[model samples]
Every structure is written in C-alpha cells, then in structure tokens.
Target: MNKETVEVIDRELLTDRDYVSPGLEIIKPDKCFPNMIVEDTSASDWPYLRREIPHNWYVDQRNNYVGFLSRDEANIVYNTALKFRGKRALEIGCWYGWSACHIALAGVELDVIDPLLAKEDIYESVTNSLQCAGVMDLVNLVIGYSPQKVEELAQQLQRKWSFFFIDGSHDAPSPLNDAIICEQLAQTDALILFHDLNSPDVAQGLDYLKQKGWNTMIYQTMQIMGVAWRGNIEPVQHQPDPKVNWNLPEHLPNYSVSNLSADLVKEFLEIVTAIRPYTLLGEARLFSLYSLAKKVCIEDIPGNFVECGSYKGGAAALLAFVIKRYSLRPRLLYACDTFAGMPDPSEVDIYNGIPANLTGFGVGALKAPIAENIKSICKLLNVEDIVVPVKGLFAETLPQYKSEIGNIALLHADGDWYESTMDIFNTLYDSVVPNGLIQVDDYGYWDGCKKALHDFERLRGEQFNLHRIDYTAVWFKKGNFLPN
Candidate 1:
C-alpha cells in the first residue's frame, strides 16, 4: 500500500468504537516498546507475543516513520507466520516495518517483497527496524512485486517459502495473481496468510482460491482480518493460553486510540467547510455522519454509500473521504440530486409548518448544484473517480438504479419536503443493509422531515436506534435483526 492508502486505514482504525489506546505517544524509543522482543515464536505463545508491540511507534515525519499495522493484528501476523521461522518466509507488503520488525525478530528469515522497497528511506527504515530487532542478517529485502518477482526467487535464493504473508496490493487482479504466484512457489504445506479480509477486493481474491479447490480457512476475523492456508492445509486458530501474559496497559486496550488527532480533525472540518451550504449540516453533524460511515465499514457491513440530496456534493465528499481514508476500495458514492432545485412541497409539507422566515422552502428554496457543478466539486476534491453525480428527480432516477443496486451503507435524505423525503424513504429504504445508517438533516427542525421519519418507522413496525445530534439533525442505524 502507498502512504495515502495506509494512512487512511490507520486513521479509520483509530476512530473505531472498540479502540482504547494511550493517546498518540510523543515518539520515543521507550514508547516504541524498546527491546521488548518476542521470547518465543511458537504458535503456543501467540497470546504472549501479541501483547508485546506498542499501540504506536509514532515517529515524526523527518524519519518518515509511519505505522499501519494494528497491535492485535500485528500479533496475529507474527504468531501465524513466525512459527515457520528458519524456513524461508515471504511477506508481500511491509509498509514502514511495523509488522516486519516483529516478524523478523521472531527469526522468520523473512524476504520482504514490495515495489516501493527501494523508494525514499523505506528500505533503510525497514532495515533499521530489522537491525533494531537484530534479525537483519537473517532477512533479504526483495524489491519487485510478488507475481513479477516470483520467477526470480528460486534462481536467486533457491529456497521455497514455507511461510507466505500476503499483505501486498489490496486491489482485485493483483491479490488474485499474488496468491496464484505464491501457491506456485510454496511447499504444499506452506502457511499462507492474507490481510484485510474484510475488503471486497481481497474477499474476491479469496473466492478465487476457493474456486481452485484450495482448502483455505479464515482462521481469524475478530479484527476483520484473516489468515488463509493454501494447498489443502487447515488453518489453526490460536486458543488463549492461560499461562501467558494477557495484559494490555490500562491506557491501551488491544492497541486502540480513543479518537483522531487534532490535525486530522482540522482537515476533515475544512473539507466540509469548502462545500458549506452545499451541506447546511455543521462539523459535529458531518463528523457524526462520517463516524456512521466508518462504523458500518469497519463492521464489514455490505453496501455502497448514497446521498439523496447532494447539493453541490459536500456530504457526498464526506462519504468519499471516509471510503478513501479507510482504503475501502471499490466503494462508489451515489450523489443523487435534482440539480434543478427542490420540487414543490406536498400538502403534508405545507410552507406554513416551517419557520415563518423560511416558508418559501416549500417553493423550492435550496437551489444547489447542477450535474456539472457536482462534478466540478468532486473533481476539485480529488474524489471524482468514485463519487458519481446522478441528475433528475429522485422518483425518476432512483427506480432505474434499483435493479442494479446492491445493499446501501448510508442514505442521507435532505429533500426538505414530505413528498420528496418520503418518496426516497419508501423507494430505497429496503435496499439498506442491516446495521446501515440513515441521516435526516431537518428531522426536528422541519415538520415534513420529521413526518417522513415517523411514517417509515410506523410502516416498519419497529423503532430505530436513533441518535439526535442537535435540534435540527437526528440519525438512526438500521438493526441487523432480520425477522424470520
């Protein structure tokens, strides 16, 4: 993964609801768990080894240190791959050496494979980590990609990897190809593991393996990560060993961070600001919106992100940002809007109910972006690749996509009128995945928006886990309790 993709994944993991770490450490050797080496790389010691790496080794930018592997998952990687130490081991990706250091320290004789291995000080930093762990002499840093580099390993190193760690390119064809290449080079009993099993592209790759009759078992999934054993090999899940150390510092539980950093908060706020009235929603609301998107994603909830009234694309941009931040590849943001301004309000949404000063809203008040305008904003934000602009009235456009629609992760209805809001609710509500989210911008402030919400709840005959962010905004999460 490149720096952007890795950072996105890192930030998303930090804000996870289950996360509880000592706030970002001011970088120091003692803070990085200095000399806290793994005593044994045995499968039996996995519970012990996992508690060794710190929550973060957050060094400053001058050294270009970036940590992407989460503490719990890092333990998974170390214990799973390092058990085959002394036999040749292959790692498809090792960005900045967070996980690499631990694996090398376990004496895996690791061969680090990545195209970016020689770029900047990445090579030096990974080596520096190995040197710190005193395993530099046992490892070889390979520079090309796995599929392309697979051919040269036998000629140069003349050793088949008994352990394969596939954390390389997270996209589809690459992961599928990487698995095939590794399978060719591995001994029949090689222990191969893949990271980011929650990712759609990676899942597709896993599906490819199953198609080939490979006996791949998803050994671990607590952190939405998995290990796959190839060539009829069964996956061994680590059962907790009572004799081992299983403590996380009171300040850090499972290596979690309570929240994002100040710099990141400022950046997310600024992005929402740039497209302001396009979104009448404020930072707190937008953050809530973002949190919902991230939560659904982290839970491995199935769906694409959607917005019923995108305006000039502010909220859409926010969703796009979340998807990119988490490296949630292949997630498309459907920014649906009329662009021609709001249609007339229904009798239930008469102008008299809104505030006296804003009664004209029923006459098409918030005229936002045309199709071209939304495109420009998405382009300016560098999210044009995934945030698509859909034009025309919701009643007309939403139905066309219904046949092609998959489940939805988020649905923000800001149509302002009962006819508009309820139209969208009835049409797309069932398309939402279980545990997905829905945000209503005018919930309490506007009677029509409130009316639409109540009607949906009444029809469903169940209440939602609604959270009110402010007087004007409230949101609810769809439960996973599908009735029998």
Candidate 2:
C-alpha cells in the first residue's frame, strides 16, 4: 500500500513518458465494492433520473435531473462503445463520469482525461458514480486538461485509439484543437464523436474531420452531436425530436450587404438620407428592401415591385429609386395602403392573449401624412412617374387594380394586423413570380403577423424557408429556388 510508489508505477504503465512532478494523477479503482449490485433503481436517480430509460427498466418515480447528455445522447455514447468493444477508448471532458460509465459498461478499456477531476469533490463524485454503476475498474481516470494532455497520452501510449469521445472545451480553437490531436492518435478506421454541435464554434471541429476525408453525420440530440469515422461502420441513427425546433442545420445562400459595390452603397446611402424623415423602417430593413429591389432587376424577374403597407412612402420611395437606377426595362412601383392609418384589428389579431388594439394598435394608429406629402416626396425623388400611389385599403385597392398590377417581382408585406397582413398574401402571393422575394416587415415584432404567415403556409401546404433580415423583419423567396 505504498501510495507514491503505486502512483509512479501506474503513471509509467498508463503513459510511458517521463512523469513530470505534479503531473497527471492516474487512479485505478481497487474493486473495493466487488459484491455491489447496481440496482435498476439507480438509473431512476441523480444524473440518470431525467434521462429517458430503456423500456425494460422499471422505475418507481420519474423525476427531473439536469446533466450534460440527454437520454438519446447517452444512448449514442453507449451504442458507439458497443461497436468497438474490447478496444481502447479515449474521452476528454468527462463531467461526473456519466459518459465514461456508459463507455466502460460496453467492455471498452477507457482513459478519461479532464482538468476538473483534480478537485477533491469532483474526483469523489466521479469515482462514486462509476463505482455505483459497477464499472469503476474499467476506466483509468487521468487528471489534466486536453490537447496538451492528449499529446502526452499519444506520446506515452504510442498506439492508436479505436474510439474517441470529445466533450472538451466548447470554445473555437479548443474543440478544433482537440479534434486535430485526436485525429492524429486515432486508428485509421476509428470513430470520433463530438458533443455540443449546436455551438457554432464547437461544430467547427466536426467540420475539420469531414475536410480530412472522414464520413461525417450529425445527430440532433438536445445539444446536438456529431460523429466522424473513416471506415464502413454505420453509427446508429437517432432522429431528432419532433417537438424541438432544429433551426436550419444546413447552409443557405443569402444576400450579403458587405458584397454590395461601392456605387450601390453610395446610391443606398443617398436613398436612406432622402427617405429617413418619411419612414419608420430602420437602416437594416431599408437596406434589405434596397438589396432585394436590385436583385429582382438584375435577375430580370419580369414583374413590378409592390409594397403592401407603405407607411409614409419611405420604403416605396427606396424601391422606386432602385428600379429607376437598376432595371433594364420599364417596371412600375405600386404603393398600396390606406394612406390614412391601420385598419381596426380584428379578433384574429390577438397576440399573447391580448387583442392587437390593446397593444398600441387600432384604427388610425399608423396613419400616414397627408396624401400631398407622399406625392411631394415622390416628386422630389424624381420617381413619381414609376411610383404610383394607390390610396385605399389593401382589400379594396388590390382587387381593383389586379389587372394593372399583373405579375409582381417583389412584395413588401408590412401590414401589422393579422387580417391586413393575410389580405396582402391572399390577394398578391400568387402574382409574385417564381424566385421573387416576399419581405414581411412585422413577422417578428407582431405575433399576429407571425400567425398569419404560418396560416398562409398551412393554406399553401408548404413552409416558407424564411431568412431573417433583422429583429422584426424576415423574407423568403416565392419558391424553393435555392438549397436550404
């Protein structure tokens, strides 16, 4: 029972490299609880309580327990270990040894490296949990940080690992750094799993593995998990929960304002300066409108530009300016609105259990200035010829001018109320040509507006892959013209 001599021998056996003073502490469980039987009830408590248990396991009470891995995520770890049973495994960042216990239970020889294990409390908890699970003897706990510690293990072991579970630092270079080092030490056909792919920075590590010729796939666990391997091994497939909103996982093409030409930037600045006093739209939203206008013209989308709720004629003015400067052929800008104020919000315009009228919206709430003022602004911009102001309710004017409006290349639906917003889509959504853009200005600010868009989606039997323009505005193309 010589403690220091046993530590030196364990270090030498686990890692052949020279042990630096105050270096990694290798703890080998002595099988003190040899007769202990981890009851099935143990799975119904602490870190495993809230996790989804296997159907065969009986539980007395199901309570909530918060931990790193969800039930599905833990299954992934256990299944991966089973695939490589009897092989050497390495895990970085083992919090309370939940994932470590899962790995050990699969008959895999595991080495878990984590900096927090140096603390006495964390060490006791991890060992106690592992011992309770009847797998403490299968895991060699290493106390140190990753990348550097991983490098030392690589040098000392001088052997490739069959499986790697990297749940290390989620910061940018930290995850990426661990992936780089792990890939070097991994066998040619090894499987490498990474947790927390929901973090953009952590996802970069998985991205690197793909770049290096590993077959990669992502599982939509609570925090998201990704696996990369080089061989024919197919990891178990876990479908994402239908209840969770897995925000767009794949890349989509978007219009970047930074790519705008210097001349276009200057033109946009001039338009914003001219219309700043007439509209309530922020610079980001106005710029989006300006960009979309240019896009339709450049692509020859073959229709007019229309604004449904032209509050004070600012956004309409910007669209008119874009057409005047960029369009190769003649195209008109239709400013459709009441020109008096917003119409009365109906019962359907309820938001968060409150009527829209109670939340600063009612008849005459967003009234525009006198018609003469809109006309004066149009004249000042020299866009009066193309900017046609159709003053009336969208319900009335849109149908009245259906033949005149014809096919629309772009639609800016700014109507704040649910009814008014739906009116714009109901009357004109079909008129928008394929690949055209429909920008909703209040989709995020007004819940009613959001509901209207969702209702429209249900009516169309398809969802619009909306792209955010700002905090309150979003836009989508008329059809699926680009990959999501």
Candidate 3:
C-alpha cells in the first residue's frame, strides 16, 4: 500500500474511528541525526535538535520522532511572525508540533500536518503537548497529505494562512510538495519558512525556490532555516509595512558588550551619534546628562544606560560612545523613544500647557524617523551591533526594559513633564542597581518636571538624595550611592 493508504488503514485497525488509538512507536535515535555533523550543512543549529526537546520524549521514540525546540529559537520565530498572529498558519512536517506550539503561542490558529501522527501514541503525545502549551484548541492536527484534504481543511476553517512553515520531510520531493501546498493554500501576503535547507535532501528544493524568485536569507550561524515572500504581495504585505527600517526582528536578540569587541562598540557608537547627534538635537538638560553619562561610561559602571525619553536619541548617542570606550561586558546602551513624538496630551497631563516644539509635543506624531537616525549612527561608528530602538510612549514601552532594569547604572529621563517623569521614576526605580544615578532633564526648566521630582522626594523621604548640578537634577540612591 502507498504511505497514505497504509497510514489510514493502520490507524483504523488500532482503534474505533471515534476512539483513535495511538500509532506505532518509533525507535528514538541514540544521538539526534541533525547534530551528528558540525558542518555548515549539519542541522547543528536546528535549535530543536540541540536544546529544547526533552530526554523523556527522546527516550520514548514511540511518541513519534518529533524533536524539541529551544526557548530562544521558539521566541525568535514567534516574534518574527508576531504581526501575523491571530491569523491562520500552516506547519508542514510538524513532527510532534514544537514549532506549531510556538506559532500558537504567538496567538495564531495553526494547521499542523504530519504523517507520523497517524500513529496513535505519537498523535496523543503531540496533542497532549499542544494542550499543555495552551494551544490544542487552536491547533488542527491533520494526518494525511492529500492536497484535497488540505484544501477542505482550509475551507472548513474559513481562513487562509498569513504564515506557513515547512518542517516536514527534508527529502527533496517531500519539501517540494510541501512548498507547493503552501503556495496553493497561503494568502497573498503569506510568509513561508522552510527548515533544514542545509540538509542534503532539501538543498535542491531551496535552489528551486530561489529560482522561483523567493526572498531568502540563511541564518546559518543560528542554524535556523527560513524563507519569506519576495517583494510585496497581497494579504501578507497588507499591514503598513512593519518597521523594517530598524530591522530588530524579534527573531534577533539584542547584543551586549561582553560578546562584542572594543572596535565594534566604538564603531556602533559612532553610528548612533551620527543619527542622534547629541549636540545638535538634545536640549540643555539632555546635553549635560549626555556629558555625564559619557564620563561615567568611561569608568567601571557594570551595566547598560537608558534614555526613557530619547526623542531623537541625542543622549543615547552619548551612551553609545561610552559603551564602545569601555568595551563593557554584557551591557548594551538601550535607546527608547516614541519614534512618533509623544503620546497624546489627553492621556497624560504633562504636555497640557507647553507649546509644542519642533515636533508636536503632546501628539503621537513622529518628529524624526527613529530607525533611520539610529541606522545613520550605526553606520558612522562602523559598529555592526544594533541599537534597539523601541517605539511607544513611556508607559507602554518601559515594560520591555525588564531585562536590563536591574542592571541600569544610569537612567536619563527627558520626558520634561510631571506624569512622564513620575511614570519612569516610580515604575523603574526599584530596578536600578545600587548606587545608580537617575538624571532628570528639564527638572529645573519645566514646571511639570520640578513638581514631579518634589512629589518623588516627599514619597521617598530619606531613601534617596536629590542634587542639582547646573541645569540638571540628579537622584542618587541612598546607602549604595558611590562617587565617581
């Protein structure tokens, strides 16, 4: 019998149609085949084959020869396709559904196709994992490869996938068929990802795809394979082309100095400085904070610096300089700004009275292109490292600072209004490592900033000390406060 007919008959004989019995047990490999070779062609980096799959699953090959996925790789793929979640997704060669689980984690309803799942036990394991991951309800597991079955599934679901992943058979013929299925079923803007292009079986398929005019990039270093729609197509390119200018695909994580060299840091800082131009764009208070941060950055501060109100990133440019100078380990200067000016004044009272500056002060309108600016700075510094530019209001965007919050040695607040200052101070204060300095721009220049600082002092009492050094106001954490 053919593979499809044999799978169906085998499944039917094991149990009643309604009471689907488990499929045949697979003999798990003693060592994952993907990791046998460390060459560029090896699945050495197929995060799933290396880190994420558990030993229990590996030992019980009867659960299907499905592999696991690393948390890092899972997050990367989820983030990369974040904009398309909640829409339809298709995963071919789903193994035990690890990648499908991740897609569902991003809030997408996914169709996971696998012939191995025809085995009752393997199917049960996959379904159990999906339910455990809170995605069983969103996932529709398909057993056979009938194009008609796939079409019917798509029609019954009344949805089309915006994202498609081919992870099934790496054999040339299987991947080629899977790609054809994805092309036929995907919506116009659908982005397709193919795994194991480095595999011998899929090499020809990848080359065929390139000839077909698909835009492809090999994440060889990470050993994750992916492909996307060429140029721009329908439903896929629908949303305002996401902020590709910054190129911080969630798939890519931020880099710290510990992993970078001095030359790299200096080169990147120069690029940031070019775009943010501390001297050219920032206000007097920001200028001073920039100067001070640069000085301390040159010293032994063991962490990253933050600019909560980096309108155009002038202060960030200064921090970038310091990041390069020290070659500090594990610290990256994070420049946060609402590329589009500020949030509406209606949401916060800070901008209620001040006249709008070069850019509308209280509106969520962009004064300058944030991504382009940072890119320019990167180019000037000749640093390959990317400066993460988060776009959103302080309240909405600060939450992402969680990773570096506890290690922040310096914080420059340039919101210039009471609500803005209060938000950052209250929310991020506890996260500041001991002895860190909180610098406030416009503390003396604007009524709103001063009022907020006073309120903070009243609340904290002796917890911290506030000092005025020229145009800027600085807060030194008590007890741990040390001098440079």
- Give lDDT tens digits, candidate 2, residues 1-484: 1112111122224332111111112233323223222234344333213123221221112221224454456656765675565578999998766678767765578999999899886788778867766667778899999899988987887867889999987777899998999999988668899887766677788888888988887765545678888753445434444334444344211211112244665576677778877887765577678878889998889999899888789889889988998898899999988888888887777644767788666678878864655676788799989988888988889988878999999999999888888889999999999998989998766778988999988888878867655446778888863332
Name model 2 segments beyond 4 Å from true.
1-259, 351-354, 370-372, 481-484
Q: Write the candidate numbers in order of decreasing TM-score.
A: 2, 1, 3
Model 3 deviation from native, Cα RMSD in Å: 20.6
Q: lDDT by residue for model 1 over 277-383, one digit each (tens)? A: 45655544676677777777677677888888877777888788778776444688888888767776666664324442356554655667555567766776788
How accurate locally, in lDDT, is each candidate?
A: 0.61, 0.71, 0.52
**Leading candidate by lDDT:** 2
Q: What digit string (tens of lDDT, one per residue) describes model 3 on residues 187-259?
A: 7666776665445455445555655666654432122455556423211111111111212223323211012
Question: How many pairs of residues in model 1 come into backbone collision?
Answer: 2
Number of clashes recorded per candidate: 2, 0, 21
Number of the candidate with higher lDDT, 1 or 3: 1
Off by over 4 Å in 3: 1-66, 69-76, 146-148, 221-224, 231-484
